[model samples]
Target: MTSELPPLPDTPPPAPTEPPAVSAHVPPAPAARRLSPLAAGLIGLATGAAIVGGTWAITANSGPDAPATFTLKGSFALTDSVVPDGNGGCGGTRGYDDILEGAGVTVYGASGDVIATGGLGNSTYDGDTYDCTFKVAVPDVPKGERFYKVEVSHRGTVQLSGKEAENGDFGASLG
Candidate 1:
């Protein structure tokens, strides 16, 4: 006896109706937004203004705490016959000792208030010019005054303009 096998179907099988079990359905991401040219420019301008404002505030606050100052430096010369004191300094008669080292140097402001004080350095005798020169330096003198008055060792004050005092271009002379 002979047995007959059934023939295969002509069409292919159908696709699956349900999604895969491993992954869930997700929506597409939205596109990135961009700022307009005018918006970008405004933002930059605002940032720059903030920085400038901060800097101005800092400088303004510090101005009062530490006022502007300058060093008042000049020479006080006594035109007299002086001899060398063997110590590389000048020596003169009584009452002339005031121009030597440690002499008080005072700087007065426009309102007659003392701004700063220092002392004279060693005296140098210039025999050629007959001048005993003493250097004076009054440091940290407050600025912004219309004029400055400098006095050395109780001597009469020498008036100087603000520009002259700040530049240290003024000097005192006594005969």
Candidate 2:
């Protein structure tokens, strides 16, 4: 046998849909403020000037608190053959050849420590003398009286010593 079912109840109808509306009291979005062409150009010019000035100062002074350098100036001659100065060098009464070139010169401090070294430069060829001057920058040398020795050597076998090697700002002669 079949059973009977209950009937459904009545219901209300639904409303139609639409896009949401914005409020009238809300303000509109504002636009971004911009500088004029002249103002922008001036600002860029100032920035460039500042950067250039800073770089120039850093380069010109070699940085603040850089060590003070002292220069040791000298000259010498070279011989074609080796001579004896009793110290495996040509620092005595030995005669040199036409000119001395490519000689390694080293300057030492008061404590017998090497201060600076370089090759001879500014060669001037006179009548019977071949001369060259060397300049070396010695750093961290304390102020006051100090002794300096300049040795001009070649091939580690023959060399020459300055005349006033351990004294004032004197010019040393090659032996």
Candidate 3:
């Protein structure tokens, strides 16, 4: 038996059309990669350090007395350099040593006035000295307030880890 089929519709079948239009132009840059925990921590630490350092430089100048005190602690490293002409107390005409005995940091108020001061004792590791840490009790930063500054000082010798960094005015936060 022959099967009868319906005639074709008036409209022709759809054509094999090309894919939808897509621009060849480069897309926006991909989002930044995520950081590992360790990397993220290190970055955070570095950023915090930079901010504090900047604040320290900006706040080294004299300012109105701060009613609140700030206890600031931070780490510092010195680059090798020639010893100053002074011949005593970590300073000698000869090349200086990287390790230092007199290393300290002073906190300043927003107005660039001295607030609190603390010393960084020498940190020795396998007969090598380093500036590792410091703790100071500054009685000038008014509590509850944040923005501030500081003056970091480290008296070290040449041929050693120390730099004649200028007294800077660093802008910072009270954290």
Best by lDDT: 1
Models 1 onward score TM values of: 0.60, 0.36, 0.30
Q: Which model, 2 or 3, shows the larger TM-score?
A: 2
What are the per-residue Cα lDDT tens digits for candidate 1 across 40-127? Answer: 9999999999999999988986764678888888887878656677666775556676667787888899999988999987788776
- Per-candidate local distance difference test: 0.83, 0.49, 0.43
Model 3 scores worst on lDDT over the 10 consecutive residues at: 158-167
Error of 2 at 14 (Å): 28
Model 3 segments more than 4 A misplaced: 1-70, 81-99, 125-142, 154-175
Best of the two (1, 2) by TM-score: 1
Model 3, range 1-175, lDDT digits (tens) per residue?
Answer: 7698888899988999998998889979989998999999999999999999999889888566746333443334332332322332222122334334454455544455554565544432221332122223333344432344444453421111111111122222111
- True-vs-predicted CA distance for residue 1, candidate 2, Å: 55
- For candidate 3, the per-residue lDDT at 1 reads 70
Q: Cα deviation in Å at residue 75, candidate 2?
A: 2.9
Query: Candidate 1 or 3, higher lDDT?
Result: 1
lDDT of 3 at 160: 10
- Which regions of candidate 2 are displaced past 4 Å? 1-64, 77-99, 128-145, 154-170
Q: What TM value does model 2 have?
A: 0.36
